[model samples]
Target chain A: MTDESDGNPIERTGDEPPDGAPPGGGQRDRGDPGASDRELAADGGLSAGAETDSEPRIAFYGGKWASTIPLAFFILWAIFQSGVLGIGDTNGLVIGALVGTILGMFFARGDWKTYADTIFEGMTQRVAATAIVAWLWAGMFADTLQVGGFVEGLIFAADALNVGAATFPAAAFVLCGLLATGIGTGYGATIAFVTLFFPAGVLIGANPVLLFAAILSGAVFGDNLAPVSDTTIVSAVTQDADIGGVVASRFKYAIAAAIPAFVAYLIMGSMLSGASLEGSAALRETATALGLVHLLSMGVVIATAIAGRHIVEAISWGLVVAVAFNLVFGLSSVSDILVFTVTEAGAFTSLPFVAVGETASVGGSLYSGATGFFPLIVLTLLIVSMAQIMIRGGGFAAIQEFLLNSVATNVRRAELTMVLGTATINGMITINTAAEIAIAPYIARIGEKFNINGYRRANILDANTSALGYIFPWAGGVLVGYQVMVGPEGLGAEYGPEMVVNPIEVVPYVFHGWFLVIVFLIAAVTGFGREYIPDRTSEEVSRA
Target chain B: MSRFDKFFAGLSFRGSTPDYDPGDVIEVMVTGEEGGEVVARIGDSTLRIEDAPADAVNTRVLVAIDTWDEAGHRGTGTYRETVGKSAF
Candidate 1:
């Protein structure tokens, strides 16, 4: 590669990357000029001529190619545990993290003290701190609404519309999109709509398979666009963008894709829905005004965040309002607000704690709201610590150098690479959030070089991240949806085998996912939404 | 070529040569000495200023771009006392 970078290499008196030093350790022949140049960039000196006179010591690889250990272990573990073993993401990450750290210790060159400090440094990195705090607040607020009947309110609204079989599928897309956006969990929306709305849609002569795909498409939209979504949160924090900025910036692309998907659903609904839904009209539950009240709570959070209040404070306000609304509006009682009732209590049998019986339950909207994110919280923190090691060891920097050199020669190519790379990762992984976390750092490092706005990079990362996971057959979303279609035993006995939709059948109908990918591709090549750095400082748009 | 392609063709970054408009203000860090010339680095590109204050070698300073060659990505600048980069 030509050093198009103007100016002579700084005559480094010291601290320059030795000619053959690779971040992974071990010697290269120094014969390959391209490899040596990349090593220099990744070595943290960054400049051809070394400046600043100081660079942090990185070690433990012992000339055996060690810096790549953490990333290698984590990626392999994610593939095996999630992709192969079909294990939960949280469990796999914890195990992968612990094992990776242990391996880092064995391969690391320095004393135990340095390794321990590195772990601490990584854990407290600004990105991790920013994301963990945001997720905590977002989780609590989301949980509060879910408990206070957000889903039920949406269902009530859908029922009252009483659209024909031809319109029911379109209604399903809109309702499921609202529910998932409000709740910030596409899987939850999938399950709720599949079990509740799916049967209802079928009675109206809505095509079951199309309805299922519509629900999934709605989920892709929500997951891609929702402010409170885990994938959205991860993408923003990793790219040094604020959640509010990311949500606002990505909205155009999301709506552009969704319009086409909605039209497709309407067309499909008309052609496929032939059965009569006459008798099921008797099955309407009174839609509660209280269930709809949670919309105000969601608005409060989004409004406060956009106005530039601290995220922690914004979420706290939303949580408080939600709990209050549940109580004051007669949506939930005091017990439902927060409770510890012992049905069979043993641990809290003493006087300080009260038990209903030998066992006790500790739950309420508040409890579930906050605790719902415990697994993900731990997952985020652990992965960040592991990421910190990779960064300091130049693992990320090496990849950064290669990306800039081999393919992303300019802004357009860089953005396209981000979209394609995120898509490939999400396609192979069964769990969407795991895929997001795995690819986020690379996106951040590569995107930074072109001065692409954090929001733009984050949008690209999340859109493709959510799109692939729900469309692929091995994806957890697709599998779970298929299982639901097949009924309780996966035998399709309850709905009858004919009603069951194969995962492949739904793939073509996942219109929103495909459209989202295309919108981002256009955004990348055209620089439609690109914003360069320092145009607005972090204080204006980010806490990270 | 399409106008759309031409419209987006000029943007590039992550360069070793310091890129700045002729009248742009930039942030630079002074790092080392090269034969009595004070070398400063900006945006990952380093060049010898030929003549700089002795004390300026280890400090971040502001500059006004006097000239630039886009293909070379190299430029010369005189110092500005006010510092520019934010805490973020």
Candidate 2:
């Protein structure tokens, strides 16, 4: 446990078959593309003809510890700049990563061409590709729901039920949790609820930050439990668990955590009541029929997803149903759902987050929802590439070895170590799915050593990953959600920076995220929901 | 660290691994022979059967931990019944 990392990495060789290359083998440099194509008769993708992939070549950053310098620096910088200073800017992280990688290049021992090729190779790893594709589908479905006036249905429900000002936050938690679960994307839930629910909750008299916390908590709940969630998919795939098995098995933990979270929201909502809404009751007498119909659209997603459809297929169905419902019910105009027009000069003219132009037309909800994750997908790719570099250089292995030796001495401790280690890493990376992918191999390896059930490992990996990613102010989920809270369009117009809920203020209030961490830790230490690997596993259950 | 966490900690599921009390019966499968020690898969993990014939390999058997090391993975088990091949 106390040993400093020192190990020889496997070198790629010509005799090795592609599958024989090793774990994360596809991440190795493909070599010179053109010449290799002719030599090996391979498609000449990454490092084909010239060199067998199993051969260990010179590392870009000299060796394992040196290669890790850039990533270590990024984590440290992230902690100081975001964790301490409270700045949650992704651009800053991008610059930090870029500069850190460039610094590694300066100290690298390999040829410049080899370093560049290796970077390209790392960028194309299959693990990153899988998560990014899932994100694209999830983002599209989430945005489509918003465009179809799903939030309006919730507002109508709130009015119809005569939800009091003191109870709105708790109600918002449950409703948003359901929406996020059906959609399987936290950012979507955050944007929709923060935009639609926050202002309405405020107009009806609720503490702004408490309301914001409830919304974030709901997103965490949905993201954790939703079978279609990207984190769920990544955890299952990376750990080789069945998706349905992971969802069903993890459901107990999520509910265990959610029970306390809901009650906390209720207690907080009552205790933290805001100014009275004297005239708010008369603002809108009747809820729109169109708004109410979108509830059926949500039901379609939840039902289809639970019935075992593939996440991409399920989301596609949800998107179609939502679009159909929107049009049939006349909930929103065609332009609202699929507009391609420039913003008019008025309240929308000063849209802070949206990039609309007078000459060039911009898209509406559907387009915005799908494309919103482009930057994140790009970031995810770069980070995965950077992780690949660490892998090839032996940095990742060194960290794994340290953890395996120092922390995981037995089955009980190993599971506990995995849960805590996953939570700690997620807090550093601040993107739940990426963090899940990064630490997944460790979870798989450690769990397998003890023959822990694949489902249990996936559950632990995802529970912590999803929980920590949303609790922190700097987490991508929180930041994306916060952007909606402060943007100068729609809800943002009503609440400027002054009224915007400070992420720090909402952190403790994110009851579900905190409770989830607690639940997983307790589960880890006590073996709650822990299932050992059976001879006949649930591979079919996952695909189901 | 708090009383709340302490209360919850006691509520977990007996640590996934079976609580190996004496006189308890369980199923295991013969997995391998390491050196002179015979290994069997029980509780979803492998353990050495203390006294089992080489012919017992790849067959199902009933056993209990002869000596359990909760902190270390390796342990020896005492065979209770030599069952046939795995049914699954």
Candidate 3:
């Protein structure tokens, strides 16, 4: 086969046989094949029969391989730095990101200018836009609610449930799940619930690990299914499905898994409720004080979100409402609110003298608000740039072509492939938004080929990815959970182990994650409750 | 060329192509880095394909495909691809 004029080997221009072609040739015409082969070749094609070739298949330490190589190293360094390896603790991810970016340039394959452009693009669009937006809006809302005592209100609500000690953890689990769904962030939910509910659960004689697991489960549930969740949006948009359809289709599967998990937590809570703490009244009073001032913020966020507003717009409104509540409810003076919002602990202290472990001053607060997302923002940029690089490098086309061809033969296998593929991407990225972006094209393609309903595909992809992310210890969700576990009043003493539930320990207790997987698998096999396949011919008419 | 031929020629074979009903059994060849050959039954309109790591010698696997007909009927026929890639 001669290479084509466009430098593409096996490139097909027309779909017809050559004139005067012999019958029964069973061979593709010169211009019959698509652009798959050439694309693959450019992307470091798999060894054809493994003959020895010194062509230097993109080395990790080299410039052409910088993105993948440095990313891997950064993850490893972060794992170690975050005390995942039980060695001396350091900021592994932070250091890894810094060193990795610098080292990446050395191994990049293109010219200095191209590499610089790629890096800048990676930092700005992927990292800055997505991660910064997520952190800023989420952080602003979280901080606003904190000042308004939203967490305290939730605590008071939980206490008022007056459930038996045996069922308290389960109740907490449900409450946390609802809170996460309402807030549209698993990490925020994990932090808030763990701070409030974990300590309360421990004080109330519940198994600390179990309690922690409940919180984690709730986080996964909300992350997997919430309409406003970044994961949900990414999944739906990427799959080309509407948000309502995605949520509705996913509801059956999510609930199936969640109900059993909820029951199991109740059972476990009953078995584990034996610990007791004194001064319940004092804790109640504190919770009540916080609760009385913050009730409206939750309502504002929920109402705005349910009104079908854009996420940013909804969150902005929520923030304004929270600020208003702070004033109207007399929760904090305007000055105090301003100071809390703007100041961090370090700024108020003397500049010349070192103060140990002080709260952030107003300037520090502003700085953190601005820069706390820098690392995530940078990582997001790198990953997106890497994705673009991969696409440009032809890796995406190669994989996509292969998937489409394979999916054409079967439907069941196609569904499973979408589920597993989404999960794998989520596992690697540990961020649902990134994972959805990376995998949505493939999922949508495969689903469409089988004529699978968009809603079903979106639900399965998002739910599985969301569920699996929190189960991986390296996942952001797990990391947040671990941070909560290690806090002063976490599960450390009660569980007799460090507060951080090893990813392994938490996996078994991540009932929602496990349940979601099983439910998806069952739905795939049983074909129960599958929705009608959309008719493309009718979409316009229906919409009109 | 006939209208159908022109249509097929212009059709995108990417993810946006409309779905087809591939009767009781459908055969597909996975071509790419992890290329392989597999056949599966179409139970619904969707199909899932799984490709392992490049080093894993196993051929790509076809796990499931939705064969459910639009009328919720289960039977044989080559369903036409209606929705095009442009919709996505």
Candidate 4:
């Protein structure tokens, strides 16, 4: 790791500060709409201590790096709460961030107004807003597909294909990967698959541990490649690349790893079936082919997104297609898609999507999908705000300068730093998207210094995030999958103690995740799939 | 690029230090000022940009490569016009 003890080497002249500084130190420039820390510092009318011609950089008691106190404290909190305690509560993370930001204020050299104003400034960034909008839309579309019986459809397909115990793990991997890719949330996919496919695969004689690994491998695949995935969105937006181009550019890496992972699953599935159960044909009675039609919805989103339509437009179209399919095919009812219920029946209650129920509440796939991301959205904004504080305090510049001047002296080392930096951060944080966001600015700075294109930078950032997120025992994906196995509503209720797969046992067998990391390591060293900034430019990032 | 072509793009091995030929026009984000001259660092390759705008750092500009030294992976270019601004 590069040392932060040194001061920022990027000297700020009296004429102009860096990208995120006020155009003129302490100048209140309302017309400049730059979204970085500069826009915030400039647009925020608060006078930063004495309003001098020189750059009004906020200094900490120790140095510029001390300005990183808030983010550093939050990282430590995340390490303890998610890594050590293994509690992946985003709300708890939000509290940690709030405390960190507040704590950082005491260390500022001058007026606290600049530090406080930086919070509001950071929160208003387009990067954070873009990610939140993408997540909400993706969540709604994914939930709609899930509610439409996508998992059941996969089960039906597996059954129809007559995938025996010897092939179940491989089949499960492919099917679960497709579901996760469509839904864009590996955690949701893990829970759903563990609840349905895990038991089914086990009862059909597939090895429990290998089956679990297959599920996680599939999730890694989707998390890395899916256009609508939160990690994908963060990687793309933070690196200033379009979601469609990012997805398309990353397909090669995902597929290269997936092929070998699928083969390993097939070979291991057959050899590890020594503990196979007697029942081979037992399957969920609800499995049906009609649910498979959601494939078209997923295809529409991917196609439209890759064709350069706006992400909001693409996902909105996908949501429309999914809702239509659910209605026409009777996959789900109108009330299931969206429902507003009241305690008492009224004239409006007769509306197709409204109902009278015991409690007054809104329910349905759309509601749940959007609501699920609420905590993450809050966490993202807070983290970005914290990051902005670092930028203003020169902590960010100090670290970047240190890395560029010392460790990442050449293009090769720069690429490697990007890969390893992302990997190390993701290894500690349970939530991959959160980790990706925290490290994104560093990756962007390092990559752009050498003119590494947005797509390559985004690919490197996301590959590690997606890979490590499912590999470690404390990872959010593994914990969610484990929770499903042990929960009363899941496999533990029906299959009892023997069905649960220990999280540690599945780590080595997560073939896709490991392969993805390996692919990136090789790519970084070999310059495979690398693109210079002038090599290409993606479509403009459309703010939602 | 077409949607289909995007998936196949970047399939080959790129070099850490790429090469540029004279008269090759390209758009690049000016990385920074070095020795009071605008420079664009593309991978390990460096191009000294001549006649660039004063505020060229972090801004995208079109340039015509005038001279290139393959051994050192360095080149000189004449700045054309600013094409874009930084993204945050």
Candidate 5:
């Protein structure tokens, strides 16, 4: 085994330098008694011969470069295969994966012997671990809360507000945003609210496109700032900051943009107010009854997260508390809740089961709660793994070093680089969670250089990634929202594909996303909310 | 030997010593192959020396480095490494 040491030469750990340091500090001169002119000139004039005259350039088209070729090829292939070029929509991810792998081979500079080992190293690194654990725990917590009636409670609460039909869109935006933040899964929030709140808004005569856009906007808001969010986790880890530090710093910036976008939604809602529908009374009563039972679930998540517990432990406690609430309130039987947890939306088969020789009918609450997140869980795993591959292959590093060397000159430029880099990655991948992980290291590195606070970096990283994820047509969040609007028994009759605010169409209505981008840019230029920034001292990063 | 060589050779021997004056602002121009150029500033240091990347640049204006105290605990200090003209 190679001897590993920490960054300090004094603290020897076997032999390897700490995480980021090069082992043995590269080649050292053994027997140089005098400071010869050639030696001094070659070694950048350092007596110890520790420094080199020229900066080490990453040899392009090397083994690292080879690994990333496949990903690029896959993107191009996916565009063609998905009929995104007009043929027919194929599985773009599959195409991307296949192409990315093939390209990896050609760009690989080293011989075949080390290829497998390098790939393995890339996959098993700490970077992958952060994304995997954060996503899974957040997924489980989101799922459990949904099965525990969190959405029903929210809907019930919304109903009781007696919010006008015209104003429902704005209210839905805020409600969805809150739900996404609490649950830490924007896609899951999108699906749940789109099914529950969007339908309700439509029944009450709210514009379907406007209502859906509001839901999408809220999902973006929560996804961008939630402490438990996968994007946030990736951003913090990559940037070498603690999750708490990241969240605390980003809060002001997120709120700055969110508040204004919210007001605009309200104004638009009022201007668009027209007709009314029936069933406000039932919706209100049902919501009020369920609201009290489930409110504690959100509280548990926020409180434990703030307390700085490990994410998995925090969410586990949240799940337990939610389940306990279900039991205490007699809201639903344990069996019913368990069944609802695993069922998917839009699938049903009535089954008769004999319990103690008594025939009981079982109906699937397939569209009910948490089960909706199963697909997202799978997607997160694949995307994160892909990100791991990218990182290990050195593509991520290549991009990061490029950004650091170019663009990240001062504090303001560094911030802009963070925002633009995160947004660009999100737009290309159409997956915010994965994009956040991919871009996080650069954000942290650049932020650290300028002593830009950790929170500011995290906020920019998360918000930009979240915003761009929904702006792209193929992004998971947009797809879910679009599906909800066009599904059978959906608002298709009133607003078909042409009118149903496709992800591209919703970009104009995605006031929150645009607002966030603008706000972040403004902050970057003006340094408006720079006070809360945390200097990512090396100690903090190593511990992190 | 040239003055530049003598100075750098001396600074290299004192591994952790500050080579640059405190609060001296130096401009570092980092050129990339394809990306373009990036320039940064270094703030101040307590040590004395000249022309080394670490000495010429400002630590406060650049990246922060985490260091270890004598007790083997972690502490943060300004980073000293500065890239000149070419940073690949």
Candidate 6:
């Protein structure tokens, strides 16, 4: 074969791909440069420089609207499973997503090969990998801090303050918010606080519903603002803004909502009556001030991240410090950080972090923490793939065009669309981060069309996602907290069924979450904190 | 911006349509073509660019403002060069 343009003779051995061809040889028209480019684009392998332009565009049978069926189906499945059924299973959602993607294949207009190739293209995108990498690092760091007794230290501080029942909700809100911010997992914070702080507050005369709301409010606060938080990471990376910059820019919005929330908890704590439960004194005895040493570990992460260091590096530093604190302060044994067990005593049994047992397995804070996000990570990649399908199929562009032409003709309307668009998606999807991932592309397209700043776009996307995720009864944060109230080892086990706060009862009392959403709504209309593209540009995403 | 400045950024209530001064050079993405001229739309404001390449649409370019109408939030500028591509 002769290269058509260059007139160079090309010899092709049977079934052997030419040089520069992607592995897993596919037919390529070597004579036509455009044909080769199309083949490479379909493969989506190597040739990073042409990624953005060469991306495959898939067409659907039902026009642009049909492209959204995969994601929309998954969202409905999520609502039904997690919201209606009250089953917060990430693995189930994964299955729903897998089925949804396979279903979308039936709607392809032409060659299904392009549609299939698009899945690999979507999964391999840098955006998905970026969030996954950060989440894994953050998972390890946050879990280590938990093993180091960060929650107990806060309980100790709350005990020392002795603010009495009237102020306990306020105090718990602040403390829970701090823990959530430090650990970057609001669901984990919700479980910890509900288990440790909820019963104590009820025993001391704080209303159960108000106290539960306060805890959810705190989770929302941290989830919205934490640099290492999954939602925060998604919002930042989706908007192409650095995590540190996103956190810094969003502080004003978070604090604006948090202040009123704290005050509401205080006022309501005083007004609402509690069941005169006993044993508050017994709960206080288990806490230790030594657990507070991990505060420095949290601080190092925040400071280093804000200084423009990579998130992985910042969390690694925090992990190192937390382990050191655990060992030096004798808070937890070295084995608690990491340990391996085998059926028989082995040479590695002598190691400080190793143990021998009848069953071979691995256990420890780091192991559990990193592994905990596995389900979520898988769900995220699948969701992003669905999103890519939408993008290539022109669903996103069609939606953007409709919104811009009808609803978002002006910048104010654009901002309002973004705020409401995000809130609507999050309301239907039980997992806030997952919902954020699904809706991020829309926010980016709408925001960029109007030249909105990256930080502002990220803040708007995260605030609504974080807030709505906890305010609804089916929300992951609320559901997790409610579970602790009724689970076998929960407050009901000790305090009786009456101690469990009904999820519906706490809806209005989630002051922080309600306020955060309202703040964004007001910001959207009043143009408060509005920024244009020319106002500022974010630093490189790698530094986040 | 410095670390300290980051926390305080975007504190103001910015206008929907901002006015630019003549001779001010700024980098912006060329959003589309208007009446055979390249244009960059920053919020409600629009700037028509002259001397821009045919393929400048959807690409970032530096432009020097040559005329302004603050009331209409519209202006004209001269394209300096292509700086980058759209961020996907």
Candidate 1 chain A: worst 10 consecutive residues by lDDT? A45-54
Q: lDDT score, residue B23, model 4?
A: 96
lDDT per residue as tens, model 5, A1-544: 0112222111110111112212221232235322121222121110112332122211125444443565566555544443253222224454566456545655544354344444443455466565676666677667666766778878877766777678898899988988898888898899889777776776677866677778889998888877777777776666545665556556666777888888888888877643444454444444545645655776787666655566667677877777787667776556544432223323332222111212333322222343443444444444444444454344554554555556564456667787787777677665566556555655654554443545556668888888877765676678767766676765565434433555565667778988988887877777665521221231143112
Leading candidate by lDDT: 4
Q: Residue A321, candidate 5: how far off, in angstroms?
A: 0.5
lDDT digits (tens) for residues A1-544 of candidate 1: 1233322222321213332343334453346433333333343321111321232435655432465687578777867775576554465576787788878777766565666666776666565566667766776677677767776787677766767678887888888887777667787678767766776677667887788888898888888877777788778766656677677667777888999999999998889854443445543463455588888887777677656566677778878888889878877666665667777657654533244644567776667766766766676666666665665565655565566667766567778899999998888766677678767867755565444546667889999998987887767677666666665654256545555676767888888998899988877776666655423322244464
Instruction: Residues A1-544, candidate 3: write the lDDT tens digits.
Output: 0111211111211111111222212232256343223322233221221221211222223323244545556555655554365322223344565576566557644354554555554454322353356556655665556656666777787777776567877887787787777666787788888766776766666666777778888888888766556677666555545454455456667778899999999888877645555434555566764544444565565555444455566667776776787777776555434443323445643442223344544532223343544555555555555544433323444465555445433555667777778777676555555556556656755554444555666777888888876776667787776765665765565444533456556668888988888777766655544432432211111010
Better of 1 and 2 by DockQ: 1
Q: Can you write out model 6's per-residue Cα lDDT over B3-56, one digit (the tens) per residue?
A: 999999987777878889999998776655544566777787877789998656
Regions of candidate 3 where Cα sits further than 4 Å from its true position? A1-116, A119-135, A241-245, A273-281, A289-296, A299-303, A335-337, A340-372, A401-409, A428-437, A451-454, A487-503, A528-544, B1-88
TM-score of 4: 0.90
lDDT of 5 by residue, B18-87 (tens): 2233343332221100111112221111111222332222122232433323332222334345532111
Instruction: Identify the runs in model 4 with alpha carbons over 4 angstroms from their true place.
Output: A1-56, A274-283
Superposition TM-score, candidate 1 onto the true structure: 0.76
lDDT over C-alpha atoms for residue A525 of model 4: 90
Rank candidates by DockQ, best first. Answer: 4, 6, 1, 2, 3, 5
lDDT of 6 by residue, A1-544 (tens): 0112111001110111122322222334546433443232222111132443445556677676777889889988999998889887789999999999999999877788888887887788777788898888888888888888888889989888886888988998999999999889899899889988888888888888888899998999989988888889888887878889889999989998999999899899989888788878898887889999998999999888778788888889988999999999998888898988777887888998889887889988989889988999899889888887776666655565566567876778889999999999998888889889877866775676667878999999999999999988888888889888887888898888767988989889989988998998888887778887767877887433
Tens digits of per-residue lDDT, candidate 4, A141-188, equal: 988998898888999999889988889889888988898888788988
User: What is chain B's TM-score across the candidates, in the order shown?
Assistant: 0.58, 0.62, 0.22, 0.95, 0.19, 0.93
Clashes of each: 13, 15, 51, 1, 24, 0
Worst 10 residues of 3 chain A by lDDT: A535-544
Ranking by lDDT: 4, 6, 2, 1, 5, 3
Off by over 4 Å in 6: A1-55
Give one digit per residue, the lDDT tens place, for model 2 in A1-544.
Answer: 1111111101110111222222334443467332222122111122221243343433543445666766777777777767777666666766667776777677566465655666787787666676777677777667766766677777788888988778888899899888888778877788778766777787788888888888888888888877668888787766655565566667678889988998997898889868443445433443454665666666776566555566667667877887787677776556666654554555554443344556657676677776877766776666666665565555655565565556765567788889898999998876677667667767765665454656778888888888888888888778777778666564446544434777878878989999998988877777777765432243433232
Spell out the clash pairs found in candidate 6: none
TM-score of each: 0.76, 0.76, 0.68, 0.90, 0.70, 0.90
Worst 10 residues of 6 chain A by lDDT: A6-15
